[model samples]
Target: MATETPTSGSADGYYDFHDHDDAAHLHALGYQSEFKRDMSPWANFSLGFTYLSPVVGVYTVFAFALATGGPPMIWAFVLAGLGQLMVALIFSEVVAQFPVAGGVYPWARRLWGRKYAWMTGWVYIIALLVTISSVVYGAGPFIASVFGFTPSVDTTIACALGLLVLATIINFMGTSVLAKAAIIGFTAELVGALVVGAWLLIAHREQSITVLFDTFGTEGDSGSYLPAFAAAALIGVYQYYGFEACGDVAEEVKDPGRLIPKAMRQTIYIGGAAATFVCLALVLSVTDIGAVVSGEVTDPVSAVLEEAFGTVGARAVLVIVLLSFLSCAMSLQAAASRLLYSYGRDDMIMGSSLLKKFSPTRHIPPYALVVSAIVPAIIVIGSRVSENAITKIISFATLGMYLGFQMVILAALRARLKGWVPSGKYTLGAWGLPVNIIALVYGVIAMVNMAWPRTPDAAWYDNWIVALSGVIVVAVGLVYMAIHPLHDRSTAPYDDAIPKK
Candidate 1:
């Protein structure tokens, strides 16, 4: 491993590498290349694509988006895809400059300072863990459906626990296994989505493309469409995020500076297109759009699948969906463990030494993987209290991730304004600042839309739950930071300079 030393490079151009090795580039960013660089560009892209699983995202949120905003909600996929593509562009540049593990956390640390990174990591870690639980828990019913069992809370919890354990074991096998699993998951999801989507569009089309513009007046008492559309945007917002996971395992990917950017953007492009196609197919296949919009028909995705393909075919598809969920949970676990290892390696959190310890032979952080699994397992266990517990836990996840991404973006913008240009292989050139500004604006608006209190008639806390949960988490982090002061504890170099090419 190379010692932490700043490599000599021009401040205004692409960073120069000592050789073709990614380790030399990583060392320049102030860290040893600990993980084996075995992941190819395709594997890296697969990790992000699986993490941003179209099947899982579309199936999970389809009913809600349709019910809340009517058929027109399909446009949210397009809006979110374009907006998040901008964010992905910003991430590519940052990761190209400082392609360190922990993705947003390390990016923010280098671009701004430790405190900002600490907060960003804290929020993102929470979100990732919760999202793991959400994905597995969400997969429970599919598991039951595939196996021909009733999906009670107990069965669901049991299935979730089983999945959690399976994914954890896979993570313990190290990066190669994880990468291969992601690729398999990506293949299954893409193939399933394509076949199912084509089938639905061809033989099961119940509505025309013009129905996509029909709102069905789901705007409710507001007498306006924008609010409903904004609320419905969560479908796309949630689907587009897993792209950042590509950078989370920077040390494991070869030529991360250049390849990771391409991987990130590809995750968005390919993943977004897959999501939109699947969503459009499902939307067009719905037999009764008004019934769905008026809350009479729930679970439209499952309904359409079963109706179009019958029980046997739907179950086969459920098998694919379950695989997507498994891969998604595994990818999320990998990302969380890497971030924890990054923090631990930097001595930025409590139990730093333990979390930083990698499996000697496997070259993976065993302790950090365990920590990642344990937290989400506990969150899954919380389902005993109420099914809604999982809902509440996950409600803040998308918001937390967006918040973390914006922190990095905001940090980069701050550094840029202070005359720090991105010296990465993937710099946006003259368009960097304009792109950065627009990304930030779009992120803030999406966050507000997500955190906005849309459930007016429900209890106040329920209505304000998303915003309230985010505030509470941040406040808790603030209190913990004040007492422990983990911000200034990192020994890792926090400079923004990259090696000159």
Candidate 2:
């Protein structure tokens, strides 16, 4: 166990080196300190919050949710919030024990074995890269609107690339700069959400709170509204992730076993509340709920913002939103690069030497960061090949992440059943088994709902894109593993992978 030392403050609120104790902990875990441990508790929490940015999540998916499930879609936030909160709990306990960089990958590696970890990381890293493209591409319209350009497909793509570049540059500056930017983004986003949601509810609410139960007949030709509600749950599914970002840089955080768990929980709780509040405000303030349900108001979130705050104020809010998007992308980029670094360190992938290289001054993986940026840039550029390419691919982002998360949850459950007790700064104790079971069940159900084909009139591929994407990604990963046998080469510890009876 690592003993906590007194934290000494610096000018930027980051702590000085007070804990060789943390370094000893890393050594005990079979790793050395290569990254700077400069992240304060607030910075750690901010990174998780920015990764799970409510503004980015709510603004990006609000219209779709409203159109797909009408005013009742707001309840999806409640369902997802509770469900993901359970996932956060499961993750917190695991991360408290592992506190390893690469989040799910290392957790899965220790909980199961390198083979399971490889698949989990492969699915997760691809999902994170695609999510970067999806988010920045989603931000294109907001960036265009802020710059007075008409929001079109072309302009959105171009602006998204530009934002991606900016985020990449920020990430290259090292952990301190990234932490500061995340703190700023978190403050702006949380404050802006509260202020905007309160204003809309108090000054511009056009419907009663009772409207939440009204579906406005979004069931379409379906027999039950449950189908439509399930489809609309995408918004909440997308919103609640990114909390795992906190654990992805475990080495860069001081006293991580204790801090990272709290950060993850804080992210799910605070980020989920912000998302639900904002979604509720937008739902209540919709000028025409029927129109939104009918798809006549395709951009209901912007409509509410524009109508309530007018053009100037809405543009200002766009600036804040742009910051949130940029912060979210940067955080994702950081997470991806750290996972790559962890893989490299373990010789779990090709080009292990280069991928594992850390900058002496920055204490960051420059090569891995570059790879992260380049892959997402390729994903964005490739997305333009079809008009709906990014849209179809983005559908897989949430589902892919859910799959990765559930893999860890399942591994943890397997470990528990094998008598693996969580011994860390934080543990659920008597509640661990029940919490783990519920989290896994909820995750699997959510995965099914997310991947279910809902669009009957669409192409077979389009309707099944989410599940198809997961299958393709997993298939490719399995092929690579079979050919290369990389997991067998991993140098990481796996004492937690107890043999089956």
Candidate 3:
């Protein structure tokens, strides 16, 4: 068991050696996981894409839409999907080439350099941590629904923390446990979507197909169907997130690069289709958007389910919600641990050595898992969950992760475009340049839109909390960088898969 490396750096430790890093540091945290080859591609896809975080995505897109509008929010989720697609495809290209722990940060380093890459990593890790908070907090309503009682914030907090502890225990058990969790998570999530989706399609009698393009040829601020589409798309974007969790455990997978990339992409597309259908069902089933809106002020899904199917439907969705929340909680803790471990190994985190240390018996970062929950236990304390706040925080992190996502894609795209990096069997081919350009532009836009203050879009005080969490996290990372100063003394060598100039 490794303890974190001391935060103290020496003043007299500057030395130059002209040897390039072997770059094992790039992969050692088990990043670009090699163990994936052991599983079938479907398992790979399921594991990579399915998990607890996607639930967070659903909450993000749907709730955000609901808050902004009403059932019309379905259209907004669709737009969100389009926004995410640009990044997904581009991210696909980058991961195909440089499947490293730093992911986007490494890509940025290659595109820009180490300094810029470090900045992005700082943001990415913090974003991930914030996401952990949101996932746990958001799981509450569902937990309450399953048991036939409303859980107070205190009860909800305990449940979430307990969920994290159990997840951590399973995580400490190793890849096999993760695979099992993925299978269960996949079944629960997909099947849940199927039930909900089928209900919307078959059970939903209204042929509101016009809602799809309701205002394309017509117009008015009376809820332009276009914005609704955009809203639905964006919400879809939220649901499709955490697809990268599969790749984070690259070391445990057999054919890490190929399977992880394929899985990551597959999860996005499948999750997208499933999410859209579910959104449609919920919107269609609602008899009175205004009444449902007012009634669901606290728990929208519960409100809509009750409104739609009465006692039976509400109860059923409650059970599903419990399943979904558990799935997300497990997957989230796993992903966050890897991120923390990644940053620690690089000493970007203060106690890198300790946090990155793997359990000799478990082959997992037990300490990392413990710390992961400990950090968020605060949220479990007295606080108005502000599920929207949680969503924004996740979105906030998603943007940070996007920076890492964008940087790497830019590097791979530049290499492929310039013929700098050797073309691989999986290269993006002729579509590389054009597709990459589109993705980069979309990424920049997404980041800017996310960062822009949207008081009209969110609760003023809650938004302030979300923004504050991200800012403080990033600022601390910068301060850590200034104090630590990179040193060659302890860093493990990098591998040849990554280039060192």
Clashes of each: 6, 0, 55
Q: What lDDT is reached at residue 434 by model 2?
A: 88
lDDT of 1 by residue, 242-265 (tens): 999999998898878778888998
Query: Over all chains combined, what TM-score does candidate 2 have?
Result: 0.94
Residue 350, model 1: lDDT of 83
- Please estimate how well model 2 matches the true structure, expressed as its whole-model Cα lDDT: 0.84
Instruction: Point out where model 1 deviates above 4 Å.
Output: 1-14, 386-391, 495-501
TM-score of 3: 0.80
Model 3 over residues 1-501: C-alpha lDDT tens digits?
Answer: 111111211111111112112133224322333222234556656665565234445643565555445555555455655655555655554444445543455445444445656676667656666666667776765667766777776777777777666766676777667777767777878766777657656765344655543322222355454443443344544565666666666555544445566676677677777777777766565444444345445455666666656787767766665666666767767767766676666665567778778776666677778777777666555345455445554566566666556665566566555443322213354565666777777767665555555455656655455446557777887787788766223343232223345
Local error of candidate 3 at residue 233 (angstroms):
6.5
When 1 and 3 are scored with TM-score, the better candidate is: 1
TM-score: the better of candidates 1 and 2? 1
Per-residue CA lDDT of candidate 2, range 337-402, in tens?
Answer: 999999999999988899999999887899999988888888888777765564565678888899
Compared with the true structure, the alpha-carbon lDDT of candidate 3 equals 0.57
Model 2 spans with C-alpha error above 4 angstroms: 1-20, 497-501
lDDT (0 to 1) per candidate: 0.85, 0.84, 0.57
CA lDDT, candidate 1, residue 254: 83
Using lDDT as the yardstick, the better of models 2 and 3 is 2
Candidate 2: pairs in clash: none
